[model samples]
Each structure stands twice: as structure tokens, then as C-alpha cells.
Target: MRLPEHFLNNRKLESLVENQSSFTLDHAAMHIFETHQQAEQVLLQFDQPVLASMIEGKKVMHLRDYESFQFLPGESLVLPSGELMCIDFPEAEYENPTRCLAMAISEEKITKVLDWMNETMPKTGGLHWGLMDYNFHFVNDAAVFQILQRLVFLFTEDHPYKDYFVDNMLRELIIRILQTNELKIYGSDTFTLRENSRLAHVVRYIRTHLHESLDIATLSKEACMSASHFHRVFKNELGISPVEFINNERVKLAVSLLQNPEISIKEVYMCCGFESRSYFNRVFKHKQQITPGDYQRLLQRSMF
Candidate 1:
């Protein structure tokens, strides 16, 4: 959702019937699509694995083996090589068009990362570190979204070391996707399935005690490892510190509380396990880029 400002302000999304634009790098390319008419059953396919995200408007996606669903902004879909997709733009118009981006990553680059993972960070089960064979759909979490935003910027921006920058970003995006898939499979659906995995163990403890006081020492105890070792491996596995993850969870709780006008903003911090108003405000603003009071006012304005 980190659309370029120029694109947002004064875009000439005209003349072209389909409106396809591209920005290509050595290892990665971003293909943009915009539809100006009501289109049904538009077939799209990619030669390489792509992370497709909805930037604006909506799409009815019909993957090969999955059920048809509405793909909206803030959602991402990862497709393997040569996966065919049938998309429907039910609400596209001249003024309100459906826009999406297909981030095609090279096969050689993906293989390099997978080889590293299989050798260095293999899973507990028989599953190896490979891309999902089928379609993988997920809500865009903050970490994943931030990486996507950066990748988009890197793809479009003209930097001297653009390839180097993109390689790092692509590597980051791959790791995040892999960890997300692992969590989707083992952490959420089958928590008991991988009790032996220290990473999964710590993730479970974090989710269960999201509102409770969480510390690296306590989480390391749950993982049965030293605090230092836990900190290193946890970052390697999940791409964030243990305390940042806890704060993210707390902010999630705070957002849910803020939806209700009956609850005062002063009460939300304590209910979400924050210690004080100043700390809560700082963390909330840091995470969401807005203070709690402004968020409350925005929500109120939206409800009107």
C-alpha cells in the first residue's frame, strides 16, 4: 500500500485499455495492472513466483485449487511459478479502477535463499524450505507490509546501488514469507504438532501471554534456551525482537479497544497491559504513525 505520491496525485491511467506498467530490475520486476471497465474472468499468469498485492479497489480471485474470494487492499497473495489466476473486477470504473501489483522474483534468487534455509534452518517436520506449491493468501501484517512498501520503493526509485538494495529487500521479503508460512502451518493450525521446535514454542508463549508482562528472560525460559541465544535465533526466525512482538500484540489489543467509543482512551492503555499513558501514546504513535487521541477522533469521524 506504499503507492508512490506521483501515482496517487496525478496519474494518467488512460489511453491503454488494460493499463499495464512495469519496473524491471536484474533479479526482480514489478508489474502493475489497472482495469478501467467491469471485467470478468481476466486470466493472469506469471513465469516466476510473484507476491501479488491489492493496492487499490477490489478483485474476485479464482485460483487454481482455492475457493474464489474477494481480494482487497491490505491483503497479499503469493503464487508459485506458472500458476494461473482468474480475476474479476466487479466494481472497476473509470474513476475508481482496480489496481494491483505482481512482484515477480527470479527463480535463481529464490533457489539461493531456499538452499540456505534448508541447510541452515530446516523445519522440524519433513517440510523443507521451499515456496508453497499452491496459492498462499494472507492478511498483510505490519512487518510484511513494511517490507513490501520498501521493495516497491526500491523497484521504482532510481538509486545507484539499486541491484544491491533490491537483493537485500528481496531476501528480506522471502524470509518473511517463509516464516509467515511456517507460522500459518505449524504455529496456528498445529501448535501441538511441533512442540519440539524452540521457535514455535516461543511464538506460542508470546501469543498466549500477549497481554501479560513479557520479557526476553521469560520467553527464553519457555524456549529452554539462554536469553542471548534466544534473542539471536528468534530474530533470525521471525525478523523482529521479542519485545517488539509483544508491543505489536499489545497495540493490536489497544486498536480493538479503541473501536468502542464507550471506553475512554485513558482506560485503553491499562486494559491493553500498558503501564502508563505516555508510554502507551509513544508506542501507539510509533507503531501506527498517529496518536491515540487522533485515532479516536478519526474513528469517530468515520462513524458519522
Candidate 2:
């Protein structure tokens, strides 16, 4: 899908912020910045650290409290909050200008997601690490490139419900990150899923039983590991505990249901596995920043 003309026309890189811009729910807090010529080092001081995966090109990052490193396309990097960093593009030759996607997400939002995980699955703590940095060689990884292209189109589009589409794309992008991690863990000749393996069986179990009542014990049993050990392995592999993973999936389902005007909030609650309407409302509102009814109204308004 091509980006709408309006969004493209409205694109303004806010320079005053000094490498950062205000956050917006309209597009998953992501931005694509391109440079035709090598520019001076870009310094960014973020309120919260970011998990950044490179989509294309090469860049060097000087991170606070971490060793400086060069990130090629298809590599991932994590920048912790309050940390200052300098990013530079050192490559001298490029047929096309270098491009990168800067996804700025709130630590608070991520924490909420983590909180949901602990609530639904008490055994799981959460991701111990705060950063995810990676590079993707889009030339070789055509599939990953295609996903990024789709996102670019959505971001440039001017549709009334562009934010909705962008949010969906963001979800897809994150899923791709998980897939990348999976491939990295399992592609090596020595890759193994022993008790300490990041590719634990619990994640697969949860994915298979989304509609079922899944808890720490059930998931741990599926992995044939103790609940505590399972939780530790899960957080190490997926960046979030098993419980948080389930709630994120549930919220994703709830959002899909809310998009359908025919589906009532009460119905959504039951369908998504929430036993109480009030609790569903609370969780949905906290994650989505709006009540289910209000979300429906916004969707309707966008349609018109």
C-alpha cells in the first residue's frame, strides 16, 4: 500500500529535539530516516532506552556503559533509557542512500506489557535485558525487506485509519524480530534446546494454546521444566516472560475484535478469555489508552 499524500507532505523532521521527536500513537512511534551523504555523528539522549534492529545500511553506535560497535544491516541493538549515544554512518560507498528505521517506544508502555505478563502468569518475571539491537541484510532477506517496504507504504499513506494500520504493521515488525531471533538460535550447527536453551518449548506451547487457559504451571509442564526454570528460560529467549507473552497475544486478539463493530465489548471479553468484563475493560483501557466503546467509536468515526 502506498502512503497517503498527506502524511508524506506533513513529514517534518523535528530538529529542535536533537535526534528525538515527540511520541505519537498514530504510527507505533517509528520513523524512517535516510541519508544520501555521510553526516556528522548523531547524538541522542533518550528518556528511555530503545530496542533497535537495523533494517538496512551500516552504522556505528557509541553507547554509554557499553562497548562501541558497528551494526550492519540485519543486526539488532538495544539502547537503555537515560543513556546517551552517538550514531555515525561510516560506509563510503552505496549505490543508494542508507536508510534506517528509528522505533522509539516508551519504557512505560513496555513495562505495562510486562506487568500484564506477571499478572496472568505469576511465575514469569520478565525480560532482564532492556535493549535489542540487530541488523538485517535486506538484500539477502527478501522477506524482511518486503515487510519493511509495506511499513514504508503504510507510513506514507493518508488514510483516515492510518494509525490503526501502522499499529498492525508494528506488531508484524516485532513478530519478525522474534522470528529472526528464533532463526539465529536454531540455525547454528551447534544449536540445542537443552534446559538452558533460549528456544524453550514453553513458547511453542503457549502459541498452540492461545484460546485455552494457560498458566505458569501448565506452560512449565509442557516444557518439561520447573515453573521457575521455565520462566527464566522464557525471558531469556523472548525478552518477556511466558505470561507477558500470552497477555500481549490476548490484547492483540482483543484489538482485532474491537475493530468489528458488530462485536460488543462484553463479547470481546469472553472471546479473549477474560472472565470478567470489568477486568477486561481495565486491561484493554490500560494497554490501548481508551475504553472499548470509545475505541469502537473512533473506528467508526475514521470509517466516515
Candidate 3:
């Protein structure tokens, strides 16, 4: 998950201070905002729904009743159309200004995409497309980041056939955004999307049974699809293979288990489904950048 720093740096302009530089096409717009001086309570509203991503520096966002939070690099916020956001540039200075992009999207284009998704790939168990709502912040993953970077190129291009390109990219961008949103809400209390989606059903199964031996065949059965078909669809929908996702979920659980100083590192790994200590240690360090024992000690120190 590297941030799209190249696109961010390329888009920056010298006149930084609500300079209002934007590129627009048929169904989407990219607004690049840079603030050189510290500012507070800067009001920003979009006529269409916007996916605001933090490019550089940081911002203190105050949206609706949600408490103030930092919008740092490698993060994004999906907002509804006509929503007013009050943002603060607390760290903006002459040398280091806050840079962000607000990509306002056309409702008509979104509706068309939504209709197509529901019609073709209709969720078997839950809601269809139209995943965009009031949910604000999200971490940028590879799929979402790549399409967004492509869009930077598309928006800046003056080619006459750019509209066709815009149409294609807009569909992709919106779909990726929707998928990102769905992933965000998957297991949380707000997750109500039950499209009978095979990938989602498989994912839901994996989340519930992370401690068990979840082989591909068993998971495929939960999705009611053949093993090979399930594998392809799972990776396509979620951007990760079934095995990688299992390990990710296990690692997430391991982090929580490590917080308990009473639980030994060996016990933590076993509970999270790792077969051996060496393997567990390698995976833990790879994902968390620290050994499980070190993480446990860090947690132990914090308790005091």
C-alpha cells in the first residue's frame, strides 16, 4: 500500500492556498487543493459526491457529528453529495502545505454503474451497488490506488477521445471505491450488504472460523461454487487470494492476542492458526515489522 506520491507531486501548483485548480470531464472532476498557511474552519462542499484523498501533510477534519480526526497521507474519505465538511489545516506552513484531492463524481454515472452491477452481478444475499453513503475515512489499498493514479493521467489529458477513456475509468474508479467501502463495512456493525456474494460469503466464513483449518474446498462449499471458480472470484472481488486473506485475518487476530501480556507468544500464534513458532514469527514480523515477542513486550510496557 504505497501512497500515490508521484501523482500528488506532479499535480501540485506553485500558487498554494485554496488556489482551486481542478480538471473536469463528463462524469468526474479532480480538485487539487493546497494550503501554504495554517487555516481553520475552511468550509468545502461538493455539488456531487466526492472521494477526498489526502495527498501530503495532514488535515484535521470535522465532519457532521463525528469527532475531529487527522486526515493523513495514504488515506481517503468517501462523502455524500452536498455534504459540508469543515476542515482545519493545523500543520500547513510555507515550506510544507497540506495537499488533498476531492474527486467529485456524477450521480448519473454512478447510477448507471450501480444498475449494471445489480443487474449483472446482483448480490445473492444482500444489497446491490449504491454502496456510497456517509462513511468518511478509508485506507487506500492497491486496487483503489492504481485506478486513481490512472485517473490523474486521464483527467490531465486533453485528448479528444478522453471522454471514452473517462467513461471507462469512471466505471472502474466507482467500482473500486464501492468495493473498498464494502470491505470496510464487511464485518462491522454497519455491514448490512448481503448480496449472496460468493466472495463475501466465503470471507464471512473465514472471519468466523480463523482458528480452524479452512481449506479452499470447504470455503468453496460455503460459497456454493466450485473450488476453482471460487478462487478466481475471491481474488477478483477482494484483491487478494484466499490464502493471503486467511493469513491477514489471522495476523489481525494475533495482534489483538499479543496485547494480553498474560498470553504467551506461542499461545497467541496457536490461537491464530499458525502451525509452527518459526512460521508464526516470520509472518508476524513480516506483517507487523516486529516479532510477536517484541510486540508483546511493547504492549506490556504500555500497560504501565
Instruction: State each model's CA lDDT, in order.
Output: 0.80, 0.59, 0.78
Clash count per candidate: 0, 23, 8
lDDT of 3 at 29: 88
Span of 10 residues, lowest total lDDT, candidate 2 = 131-140
Best candidate (score: TM-score): 3
> Over 4 Å off in model 3, which ranges?
1-16, 189-204, 232-239
lDDT of 2 by residue, 54-107 (tens): 655677777655676776665555455676768787662334445556566565
Order the candidates by lDDT, highest first.
1, 3, 2
TM-scores, all models, native as reference:
0.72, 0.45, 0.85
Model 2 whole-model lDDT (C-alpha atoms): 0.59
Best by lDDT: 1
Comparing 1 and 3 on TM-score, the stronger one = 3
Angstrom error of the Cα, residue 103, model 2: value is 0.9
Overlapping backbone residue pairs in candidate 3 total 8
* Best-first order by TM-score: 3, 1, 2
**Candidate 2 versus the native: TM-score?**
0.45
Cα error, residue 201 of model 2, in Å, equals: 12
